[model samples]
Target chain A: MTGIPQEQNDLAYDVFAKACPSRGTLEHVTGRWGGLTLGALHQGSLRFNELRRRVDGVSEKMLSQTLHALERDGLVHREAQPTNPPRVDYELTPLGRRVTERLLALIQCVEGSMDDVLASRAAYDAGQRS
Target chain B: MTGIPQEQNDLAYDVFAKACPSRGTLEHVTGRWGGLTLGALHQGSLRFNELRRRVDGVSEKMLSQTLHALERDGLVHREAQPTNPPRVDYELTPLGRRVTERLLALIQCVEGSMDDVLASRAAYDAGQRS
Candidate 1:
């Protein structure tokens, strides 16, 4: 836990605060495309189309936007190579790797709980019909 | 790491897959309001309005929708008590708690990294202008 004093902590970026800049970064990290993008990059660096394939369904536009936001936030590093037809690769920065470690844990947790989640959804739906 | 066989794992729900149900649940858990809502409930059970306040900027409609998604997914338990004005409270289910444990780790990581994130933003912006 953070040992920072309560008053100092209050001044720190609190995601629960509506106006905090951290909220924006959190959204970028956990956003629909962002999480998937980062998760894909965690394996290794990837080119644009390769990332699109690994993420499965991100459009070129959304992936580009997601990458720009992440790169701006310093969670992702984009390297554009000058070669035949050009090659741009995306990889997680040190900070991004740390964030993704936690994120992948959360992702795997949810993946592991899918059975329970499905059952719960079924029960909830059945209750609604009765 | 999951020891499941690679062949069997391919059949399992994968967030990276375009059509996996786990992807939907992931979206719900990490959605704009979902993460904040679950994070708030991690403290203890809270009434609807209290959740709204704790999450800082959620509108009533969004909060209601977020809770329903979470409840249906079995990450949140919603209790409607019989009392004056009809009390309703929200709390995390066991599975929810598990998910939130990982989530709060990610959230705290983001919160703690705000200084670096801010500095990164400044450097990124300056580079853009140069």
Candidate 2:
């Protein structure tokens, strides 16, 4: 897959490559707000307020930015409601669902090792101070 | 797990919370160079230059910073040899191996959907132009 069909494959970006768009996409997928937003949306479609609460600690500006990024990435779909005040709902697209599953799996694994990680940090910090 | 054992759990940070240390650790696990470094180290131990080559396009400053962060987190261990040239090898710690496995899983999933993501971006940009 390295050098095959240079013209065609050249268009396909590799995250490992510094110049690739995939690197940016990867960053968005794993960023702090991005990760939390996906985690919330993974549960179900969420309105603006619901999403804001679900992610916890995310400000309106940050949530808006994260959803915009996700929507632009085609992982999320935003639908506006026909109401006097206007309402918007956010949901994960098929592509978003796939990415969320993988990310959540990683999050779970990290949580799984929380005990070990915390312990290691304690030990490391103690050693560093000595 | 939210409010149980306030004192004990307080010490155990939650990533969802804004002030949690886990959030920073999670970011490191998923950052550009951090992700690539973990992917490379997941395979096995490697010397400094070998690691630099493996995670292509990483500057010496960035790699050093990333490795320092990972080491401080106890996710990576650095072994320096007693040679005149001072050879150094980096490997994933047990906790690191677990985190790396999960992070790599996410990275692979992202790579798996590269086609969809790229196509989505193209369609998005095309639509924005219209």
Candidate 3:
């Protein structure tokens, strides 16, 4: 078929030209801690400590930042209980679930082919050395 | 059904516990400039200058760094010709193509649902204001 029709082209341009808010969404979702947080939350609703445990190396400050960004973006729902200990739980919204599912699929793809990627790196390094 | 069986659990733990090389690969492919570079290379082979143009807002140093990382990972092949100005072209290897295709799919998904993300952010901000 031919290229995208004129109206479709205009619509596509609008996304890039208008500095669409999705750019912010992307920055939030793909930020350093954001990816790991979403990945961890995909398993289930997690309390602060649980999320901190799962995302191995993330510092408390970074984790808090990431959660705030995701919360602001409406991808994550944070609920605080007025209990003795003041417990808080984080879970995915419907939109968050959709995004996390996609993120999980991408992670799985990466995990599945990680062996090939390693081998490729080794060979590339060998070639460079010679 | 119950949770993953013992063997599966052990296998899953192996991925994270070993400090796998995939960590570096992830860093390379997902770096600031790396994502955009891979997305552009998915289209076809591009000269250095051509790539520089497509990835908007990328500085020369960042682009160079990204290309080097991809090349080192064997996800990009750089062919430098013996010519007056030292003509060079960048293209994805078979491995690179596979990775780029996946990246492109992710980008399309992000682009496709951008409107919902924007609306979500707006609603979230309104809630914060009230």
Candidate 4:
């Protein structure tokens, strides 16, 4: 098609016409630590330490920052209980659950096709060297 | 379900088991300027200056950096035609096209659901204050 179909064009414009909400969501959801945190929370509610454990390479500072962003955005619900050690738990809010489901699907799609992408990279690198 | 279905778990593990190629692709696709560049190129091949115009808010330095990453990863084919004005056209390789199609889909999905996300954010902020 020479241009996006009118309906699709309208949809795209509707997205771009606003003050750019996607930029913020994209920042929160796709941040370096954000994806891994969401992936870990997808399984169940987690304490701060539990999240740290589940997402392998994230440092304490990054994980805390990511959790705060997600929390502020309303995707994650954090509850603190008065206890000896100050127990806290994090779980997806309804909105969080919906977004996480979509995120997981995207992650799966990427992971599934990664082999082809790697092969493409190898070929591209080889061509560049020769 | 208590856990991801065994098959899905295998798939997830398969993805996490590797040296994490998704990390690189994720970096390229979701880089600050990368998504916009891909979206602009999706319409058709264009010269360097043309791309700058189509994707609003990108700077020359960021655009050049993004193009190089995509080029290295084989998602973009940069054809430099030896001519007086130095005509260079950037287009998607077969791999690029495949990936771009998926990226566009993701962008559309995010755009479609942005309103809900905004509403959620407002509610979240209100809750925090009270």
- Which structure among the candidates has the greatest lDDT? 1
Q: How much lDDT does each candidate structure score? A: 0.91, 0.81, 0.71, 0.72
Q: RMSD (Cα, Å) of candidate 1?
A: 3.4
Better model by DockQ: candidate 3 vs candidate 4: 3
lDDT of 4 by residue, B36-116 (tens): 787778888999999887767778998898998898776788999999988999987776776667666656656655656
Candidate with more favorable, higher DockQ: 1 or 3 = 1
Leading candidate by TM-score: 1
- How do the residues B33-102 of candidate 2 rate in per-residue lDDT, one tens digit apiece? 9988988998899998899988889999999999988887878999999999899999999888988888
Rank by lDDT (best first): 1, 2, 4, 3
Off by over 4 Å in 1: A1-11, B1-11
Which whole-number lDDT from 0 to 100 does residue A49 have in model 2? 96
Ranking by TM-score: 1, 2, 3, 4
Which candidate number has the best DockQ?
Answer: 1
Flag regions of model 3 displaced more than 4 Å.
Answer: A1-20, B1-18
Model 4 TM: 0.78
- lDDT per residue for candidate 2 within A9-117, as digits (tens), equals 4346566777777778888899889998998899899999998887779999999998888888888999999997999999999989988998887876665556566
- Candidate 2 clashes between residue pairs 3 or more apart in a chain or in different chains: none
Q: Give the TM-scores of the predictions, in the order they appear.
A: 0.92, 0.86, 0.83, 0.78
Error of 1 at A75 (Å): 0.4
